[model samples]
Target: MTYFNDFDINENIKKAIKEMGFEEPSPIQEKAIPEILSGRDLIGQAQTGTGKTAAFGIPLINQITTAPHVQTIILTPTRELAIQVSGELQKLSKYMKIRTLPIYGGQSIGHQIRALKQGVQIVIGTPGRIQDHLRRKTLRLDKVRAVVLDEADEMLDMGFIDDIENILKQVNTDRKTLLFSATMPPAIRKLSRRYMNSPVTVSINKSEVTAPSIDQVYFKVLERNKQESLCRILDSKDPELGIIFCRTKKGVAELTEALQARGYLADGLHGDLTQSQRDAVMKKFRDSSIEFLVATDVAARGIDVNDVSHVINYDIPQDPESYVHRIGRTGRAGKSGEALTLVTPREMKHLRSIEAEIKMAIPSHAVPSIEEVVEKQQQSWKNLITDQLNDDEDLSLFNALTEELLEQYEAKDIVRSLMKLNFSSAIGESDDGYNFGETGGAKGMIRFFINVGRNVNMSPKVLIEEISNAVGIPGKAVGRIDIFENFTFVEVPEDVAPFVYEALRYSRINGARVNLEPAKPRPKRENRPRPARPSR
Candidate 1:
């Protein structure tokens, strides 16, 4: 029942927040904003998507005056987070004429320097780039009144702790410091202890911190088959509005292209997009014009859209807490929503850790079949036809066309032709019913069988990586890998198979020596006839 008014934020900021349609302050924002505004150093413990950006941004903006230049700097772990935080701060400060710039790699440093020279009030940057600017003397923090270490644990995990420490040292010694992280690891605690000045510690309850409405599920899939399997599942579930989480911005773009090629209304969100472009994509998604959003975790943060039906993990998150945050996009406001995770064999331990932390075992679900997709499409078409028939308007035009066609062709024939056209167009032409061979890689490829299978928890991803690394072949050069319990079958270019065999002869994965040999065709079991004696 608590709301944003309790924070007593500036009227302009509050108005902007209201226009953004946020009524309640998330627990972390509620507890941390006031303390941050009181000129006290604070440590906020909260998870992603908890409105942490506004929590820190509101107070930071309130303290800055139009006269002071670049008086606040926020350090984030990834470039995506840097851009996202900067944009959110800009939105919250729209009425105040406060200038904020996001500085990170993959962008023109010369442009950042120009922006810095223009006397921006706040700089939000990734640690490495911030350090680069500091070393170049393009960034001057002498007048910085406050510094925020956002996602402190992520910075530590990413080995940016040293960069953060260096940046902190460069800022004004008397500056107020605020640290926010999802978890309080000892490393984060130590960093805070060294930098913060008797900071007030505010912790939102862990259960309340995570979205409880998300129903999480994981599918054990081989790495090579993941792309195909994911396409199938997407076709099966057909979420109305959803986001697929990938690990990197490159991955986001790659997946977005792949999804769009498959005829899905999907778009990528990442640090690479300009502010206007990102705004356009988010607007389309929120308005239901875009069905799927492919994004990295950092880029997806601070997204507060409702009615997302699903959140999918295209790759397993590196940490358990990230799994929690990715799926939290769906199943909100007492509505049931689904979260699907694709996990490789080696990542089962990571999945178990997530289950232990969340105290829920995500049920194992079968990958949807191509036939099932066809069936769903057919049903949907039938429903559409039925809905049209129920409409009160006259159908004289359609009826006349039907009658003319019926005069030349029997009703069954016309119907069959129409059905064929509809189904063929929907499913597209099949490439000779071959699974892996359609790409022309199956011709000269020799299949190798390894003695690891379902029993040993072998997955396609691990098998492909091991084979690729051991044989010095690129991952894409290796073909299909089928994992069965106690064994796996991998395809390699026939020319490279000999080299692969020699290379992996002594390789061991998970403490078991990998046995490799030519893959044998599976034997088909013969059905036996009932004995004649039974009739007697």
Candidate 2:
């Protein structure tokens, strides 16, 4: 959980990371940033989405000065990756007077030459285009501090290895060399061994199975309760930017509407949206105009926003890979992040399967109470006030009023009163709000009382068989079944309870007509007569 603030970096870089909304460093960033900043040549083995860009980019931005000359060159495989890398660098160097130019094949070479002559501080481009500049004698690496081979494997596979070597040969001395690749194939390794100086290798497994900086948790909730659960989490967490992943386009639309109805700055992205509509929504999300983005997996493919503080899986992902990809969207840019999932009882097994795939256990949490949400909101208010006071430097303007108030009232009482005034909606909220009422049984189960039990030769097996047949579900779908002489308590999945109740109520089970309904807490003691013991 290394934060960007923990780094021995300058205020300009710190301000840039903050503006980009990175709260904690990703695992790669945590392991690699320090090594890179210490002036060590490093080899990073990580996948594309593992925040490798910032892992290398942050250190480069921190070390490079505004001396009006290029200090680093990042070589990527494609024009797309080159442009993407350049965009991320610009964001990281926003507070510094640093310039980054993306030179690639499709773009005008003359334009790149012009930007280069104007003294770009960092240049990211495909190896081929960089070679073009070198051939034209328009690019100079004499003063470069570092050479980053980003996606080294991809560049090699795209036949840029020769060009990469030629370009690296120019700045082979007195410079740091960072090589990042998803896989260390023989060719890339040979090149690393040839060019790099005793590099310290930091490997964040190529699959990126886990986002170590993102806190992962789940809520066992019913299908109907998911939207409200998400809303409550949003209130409690108050993320700066969030992405809620749904399993379908319809789910995205519905969740987006629900959030928007509750006054969240939300928009939806799905297969149904036109490209223009999606671009608009993404623009809003990136610019902080929209606080949340509700999206389906396919629609969220190219999303690379760095400031997403939270990733909420409104529906649990279908597989472990999707889960990893979804949560990886947060906790980037050296910022701590949160990942929340809502799973129905029936989906718990699937969730467990995903957990097994990722080789990690996801802890379950009870839904936040309205009281907790209010407390979080009040804490946010406290932080807001504290930041204002700290930044003001001249709080003497309010010293007289504070002293007078302290004289009239106790400090705790005065602060509490002020908090109440500042956040009336939160202070006035009733603690009894959002009582979903005795969830019938455990997290994802609903308990039901069936009037016929042991008296009619009823047993767990018989009850399971009858219920499964009646409800068209598997026998294993029923949870715990407790047989009493006259009535039995049965537990079933939450979303299926209504169907079970409808199918079994006033219906014959084991030759006796039975009544069934959702049970209250099991009776302490029953003082009723037992019915005749009958056979099925």
Misplaced by over 4 Å in model 2 are 1-49, 54-84, 88-203, 206-212, 271-276, 369-536
* Model 1, span 1-536: residue lDDT tens: 67877776678888888877788887788889889888999999877666788999988887888974889999987665787798889889988978999998878899999988988999999888998999999889988999999888878877898898888988999799999888889989898889889999998764564447666777755555566678777778888888899999988998899778767899999978886788789889989998999998767765766699999999888877787767766766456788899875445556777778876677777666667768878778788778987999888868878879989999989877887775553454333111332222367887777776766557777777776655445789888876755677678887556556655655677667777777655435734223223235
Q: List per-prediction Cα lDDT, in the order shown.
A: 0.78, 0.80
The 10 consecutive residues of candidate 2 with the worst lDDT sum are 427-436
Error of 1 at 119 (Å): 3.2
lDDT of 1 at 417: 85
lDDT of 2 by residue, 1-536 (tens): 57889999888888988887778887789999999989999999876578789999998998888898889999887655776888999988888899999997766899989988999989998888888898899999999989999878767766788898899888738999999986678999999899988999998752353556789998765454567667777787788999999999988888888777667899999878765677689889989999999998767754777799999998888776568768878876567899999876556667878778777888878768767777777667778898987794766788899999999999999977887776654333343212324635777888887877777889988888777655446898888877878788888887667556656666787788889877776455855455455568
- For model 1, what is the alpha-carbon lDDT of residue 113? 93
TM-score of each: 0.63, 0.49
- For candidate 2, the clash count comes to 5
Candidate 1 has a TM-score of 0.63
